[model samples]
Target chain A: MNNWYMLTLVGNDRTGIVAKVTRILQQNNCQLGEASMLRLGGNFTIMMMVNSELSSDDIITALQAISAELNLQVHLDEIEGRLHEHHIPNVLVTVIGADRGGIIAQVTEKLFNVGFDILNLDSDVAGTDERAIYIMRIEGQALDGIESIEAALQPLKADGIDISVQAIETLIA
Target chain B: MAIHPILTYPNQQLKQVSQPVDNFDHNLRAFIDELQETMHDGPGAVGIAAPQIGHAIRLVIVDVSNKKKIKHHGHLVLVNPEIVEWQGLAVGREGCLSVPDFTGNVVRAERIKLNAFDAYGEPLSFEMEGYEARALQHEIDHLDGLLFLDRLVSRRNDLFERKKR
Candidate 1:
């Protein structure tokens, strides 16, 4: 039986990182699964699920040459099951304002207290280094409905954070 | 008169362009009834297209009356529907019955002027805005074999995994 493993690689951003890493997996007969690969702050990060008959150590050994060639930090952990199971997101929350500390913490705390499970989140800084603007978009499911989620985030408005909550309804057409 | 099974992605039929409706006869009326029934059968489905049920015809049904505080044309059965004019642009999250596993943010026209035919082959023209316009645009796309995935605002970040209840 094939086993699932969470494989992660992080290093300085460079072209051909994906091509080289995926080629190694292909050569090793490792079946690729759901993956998220992106560049953040001059670093390329790859987090993916792989299914293979080989042991984790064997997979690591197979990747050793490419890892050293690209100077990438590679790590793998055996997982019991797949990690990309689908989840329907019910609410979309956007937070934008002057960059400051505790924005993520305070916003997440409000969501966590109400049993809201975040499915996807993306944050980025814009504007000049002298005046930076923090923008974050979070998609999640709110079991308690949008009104409650809105109420929970209402307090943040007082702090001059431009926040908006929208209900995400999927119309199948 | 029947609730047909929805054809999901990878069902190559969903990718083929649907033919324009030329005859609005007895068969067309019966098929329209089936489409309405199928739309009602889906979970929270406000619109549906003929191609979604494996029928490659230019036909769709939309009913946004159940939606609160939105102006809608009640029940709409558009035959050979086409958007003649559009205004503004907005990004909204959309999920499809054919692609149930994920939802994506798609850019759609905020307002639209549409021309279509009713079930009886009579010409109909109207204007729609807000959610109704978005729904119509999505249904019309099926006639051209375009899914929301094809129109995602940002492929890298707009697509999201949808949890099944």
Candidate 2:
């Protein structure tokens, strides 16, 4: 059986974390697969699935040594395998205009209830702090059509708040 | 001859920067005709680029005049087109025939002053606003090896997987 593992590393936000972690993994003859590194709030985090020749126990000991040295929280565990992109119809939902509370909640709730799969979402509070503007882009699968999704988002629109849902073929590009 | 096959991504040719259309000959006119035919054959297509038809030349056609209510320059064959000045911003949902199956919300110049040579090799310059301006910008990007994806507001969330048309 192939040895596939999920590895997560979180520590203070600093450079060289990736270099160090990957170097260790590289020394162990581990091939990095889908990996993501994110800086959240104040700390940084790294998550990846890797295929390796080393066993789980061997990887755990190697990672623990680095964890103690770098003041990081490291977790390594065996996993089944990987997930590939599915051939599903996806939609792009963009919401802009005035910033207000409960906007994300309201929008997400409606989309979720209607079978829209939230693949990716990014939002920002721009304009000015006094006249705070909220802009968001959501990529997901809308099982229904764009018209129905638009209708679902209709109530969210006000004088300045604009919400639009349209079919997007994102994977193509 | 007739409608040519639209090249999709990874075709290498789509990314190659197009050379300027230096000559306005019979072949150029026929190529423009083929592009018009291809655009009409596409699903709600508004414009097409020469690179999309395997010709790396600065030439594109746009005809949004027939679709809905919008002031337009009618069917235009802009050769070596350039946007001299731009103003304001408009966000519109756009799809490309070459990049089929996907559409994106792109922010474009709400108004523009464009300068270009017509299909007959005559110099033409004019101002375009609203939908017409947006369409011209989208088609022009293709000549410069740019796709709507490159202009997406946010790649992570702005990109959507479209259902097959």
- For all predicted structures, in order, the TM-scores are 0.92, 0.63
Q: What TM value does chain A in model 1 reach?
A: 0.95
RMSD for all candidates, in order, please.
Answer: 3.7, 6.5
Positional deviation of residue B43's Cα in model 2 after best superposition, in angstroms:
8.1
Tell me the TM-score of chain B in each candidate: 0.92, 0.90
Range of the 10 consecutive residues with the lowest summed lDDT in candidate 1 chain A: A80-89
Query: What lDDT does the true structure give each of the candidates?
Result: 0.88, 0.79
On DockQ, the leading prediction is: 1
DockQ of the candidate models in sequence:
0.48, 0.10
Model 2 score (lDDT): 0.79
Candidate 2 root-mean-square deviation in Å? 6.5
- For candidate 2 chain A, the 10 contiguous residues with the lowest summed lDDT are A164-173
lDDT of 1 by residue, A1-173 (tens): 55899999999999999999999999999999888898877899999989999999999999999999999999999987654367878888888899999999999999998889998888888887999999888889999998888999999989999888888865556
